[model samples]
Target: MSGAPIWIGAAHCVSALGEGPRFHLQRMRDGGTALRTVPGLTAKPMFAGLIPDELLPAGPRRIQRLLDRCLLELLDDLKPRPHERWLLVVATTKGDIAAMEQGDAAASALPLLGEHARQRCGFGAQPLVVSLACASGTAAFILACSAIEQDRYDHAIVIGADALSRFVLEGFASLYALDAVPCRPFDAHRAGTTLGEACAAVAISRDRDRIPEVIGRWVAGSIAHDANHISGPSRTGEGLLRAVQNALRIADLRASDIAAVNAHGTGTAYNDAMESIAFERCGLSDAPLSGYKGWFGHTLGAAGLLETIVAVQALREGTVLRTLGLSEPGVPGRVNAISADAAVPGRMLLKTSSGFGGCNAAVIIEAES
Candidate 1:
């Protein structure tokens, strides 16, 4: 965690709970879920965490509106020169799928969203888009760090988002992966994930002079894939175990140094069990850990970025969030799971995410002293 810090620059978000990163933190602290029962694509009611209809404009391009709001605020905070080497990176699973679902014949170009972001934000560097199933958000942040470290760009604006669409809801529902009620991560009686929508962003740069404010450095990140199943995580937690260990090693810290763990905790049966095994193998058995899915539902690509943003605030304020729906520790591994929020003793936070196609990513965020 040493060396010239890659300034956090700025970060923002819009979720069901509300707008802004800090607002989401306080809402979570209030100890209630923002998700509610909504009619499914059909008449059947299902739990989902959706952005309030009022927060969104009356329009078809809702994804664009959500992302623009975040990027607009981020660029305003950084106040970069028009010619600055700023890159726009977009992370999403179903990029503007609404247009396609609405019968727009020309919406198949997936990278169109990122390019639009670059133009909207006036970025000087070409945009990069990533779609790694649910791990897309964290992977985008990790890529931003690598690009900055390699001098490919002076600053990186990584924004990730996905909205609930008929295609996505039916897809998960067909697979029987969605819960009838709100998703509960790591809870013994947890059923499955409830779909949600969110847009989140973070700015990263090596030059502190260009950043208005510093958010802690992104110390280390690692991504691994077990290739065990296309839509399922490795039953043995093989990929996640390696990802966490490698992330700790890259941060040059042992397992004990991590003050808390912000796990993906999608509330699915296999995913929860796999994360527990991975944490135990990483020797992070005693670290306080909880998942944010219960609060925000599974926002898919937006999940990791939204969670990471809130985690930065948590580490800075020395707070550890409780697993909202977790009453009994029921994962297979011996990892420590907290039911009630507590104070954190250290500054480093280990953030991990696992997604379909066996993708697993671990990122370490350190709070500035």
Candidate 2:
């Protein structure tokens, strides 16, 4: 944890919940569901949080359009110094995979996506493509911070984008993980997750003095894998517990110092329950908690960065966002799941994510004074 303090300079998101973190946060606060029962890119009548076609930039490749729009907006007015070395990190599960399915073989390769981003962003270094299942976005943050701390780069642009594809939709559908309606995380009647598409970006830099309005600083980040199952999480929540503990240790903050917990409540029976167990084990059971999948669906690789940006907004506004679609508690642990938006007293917040392949990540964000 003895690293340079990485500050969040700017962030933006384009998703089914609309563009930008502020707009999406307000939609969450308004309380409904961005999920719609529409014909999916794969099948008919599947509930999904699909970005509107008009919002997508005109292009032959949909995934590239998604990435370009978010990057353009995120880097707007973010002028890096002439001597500063920059790193471009792209986190995604499937990048232009749908195009690959449509006979574009190059689209299947992550490097192609990375090359496209590097050229567009005018960064000299080759982009690091992180395809670590659902934990890609959170893992990207860990990589960016580590690189900056080690003096590998002066600034890092982390972008996570995943456009819906038949390959991904069919895979999740085959697992019976798609909900019939908008997802309800931690609710007694929760069914499953709703797949969503989004592109989210955040700029992290050590030059906090240059970017004065530092929304939050990356205090600590830790990632661990249980190797328990390919898709299923550990029933004991051991991996996530370890991640939270490592993050807290690195940040030198106790569980009691956390003002809020943003759990990866994907509305699945096991995922939500496992998260509850992890939080309880970390002594964060009573912390104000929320799951935002109902608001924008699970944006696959973009979920972590997208949600983190929203959490940054919450820290700036001094509020805890409500978990959309949650009604009654179903988990065995006594988590204080936020049902309504409320003002929070402290500035420290914890964000956690658990993904396929038993991957788990936790990061602490503290509002800048």
Candidate 3:
């Protein structure tokens, strides 16, 4: 199949590292992390990369307000053509759960998010919401690209947002996946993951001249289900390996063309081990790989896009940041847990992500001249 050119015009992110691409790049370069313990979260132990209370909106209406803030900033930066109709794709695993936990006022207010955007920003297009567990963000991007390729729309704005919630916190804690300290992905002493809350939006278009091109193209991506477990990944890494191979095949690229890999390292015993095995099976064991979960914790649905933005920035800057807390390899594979800056002048980057419900997705992005 011939690939359609989809340009990432602008990306805006708010995470533990900070806001915007520059803030995240600077923080990664400085090697700083902001994972902290959220007091009274639960007795099971938990760490979260939370947006500062001062920065978060007050009350149950906060998430919608915060999402609006981020989306508006992205739209302002792009200032897309006035005559063009945009397709807004919003992805989230936990949409305003915190607000719902607060009761009726918050629950009722959450669904109004889409209408709020249309009325407030005059988007003039209907918004679509996608909630496919943790893979929601990346899947949203794929959907946008497919829509454009099929001539469903000329442009699509993808936004991913999730707020911290006690329900999710307790659920993961019940699974014993909450780390007491900052997460250490692929480390010998790795425990589990930390939670994080943030919102990110990326504007993609067919107009290449208006976008900031990065190394590699988003040629192809796929989503698959293990169908074996609800929360646990398949032991053989079957689903993940298949997704990677399918993405590479669809892109008409080989594993050798991929210069680096942004792994879906959640620091859990099962996830880390499975991903390592998958990479080796996919013939990517020798490729330099790293995880951003340690830097921003696992932002759930927002993680895919947030990490994609990070990888794009790395390609643009020609340097890969060390995995923040990785120390001493643990998984039984050839996965390199290297620290320090590494120059990645290669032509392609293969980015992968996996989530609960046994869902996995991978996208190959290339730099454009």
Report lDDT (Cα) of residue 206, candidate 2. Answer: 88
Local distance difference test, each candidate: 0.85, 0.86, 0.78
How well does candidate 3 score on lDDT at residue 24? 85
Model 1 spans with C-alpha error above 4 angstroms? 1-3, 57-59
Error of 3 at 350 (Å): 1.4
What TM-score quantifies how close candidate 1 is to the native fold? 0.96
Q: Which 10-residue span in candidate 1 carries the lowest summed lDDT? A: 1-10
- lDDT order of candidates, best first? 2, 1, 3
Off-target runs (Cα >4 Å) in candidate 2 are 1-3
Error (Å) of candidate 1 at residue 346 is 0.5
By the lDDT metric, which is better: model 2 or model 3? 2
Local lDDT at 24 for model 2: 81
lDDT of 1 by residue, 1-369 (tens): 225567774778998889987798889998589998877654466788889878764445888888877877887887768777787789999889888877884784668888878887876577889899899999988988878777777788889999877788888888888887788788888888888899999888887667665667778899999878998889889999989989888778999999999999999999999999989989999999989888878888888899998887877888888888898778899988888888987988889988989999999988755
Instruction: Point out the worst 10-residue segment of candidate 2 by lDDT.
Output: 73-82
Residue 233 displacement in candidate 3 (angstroms): 0.4
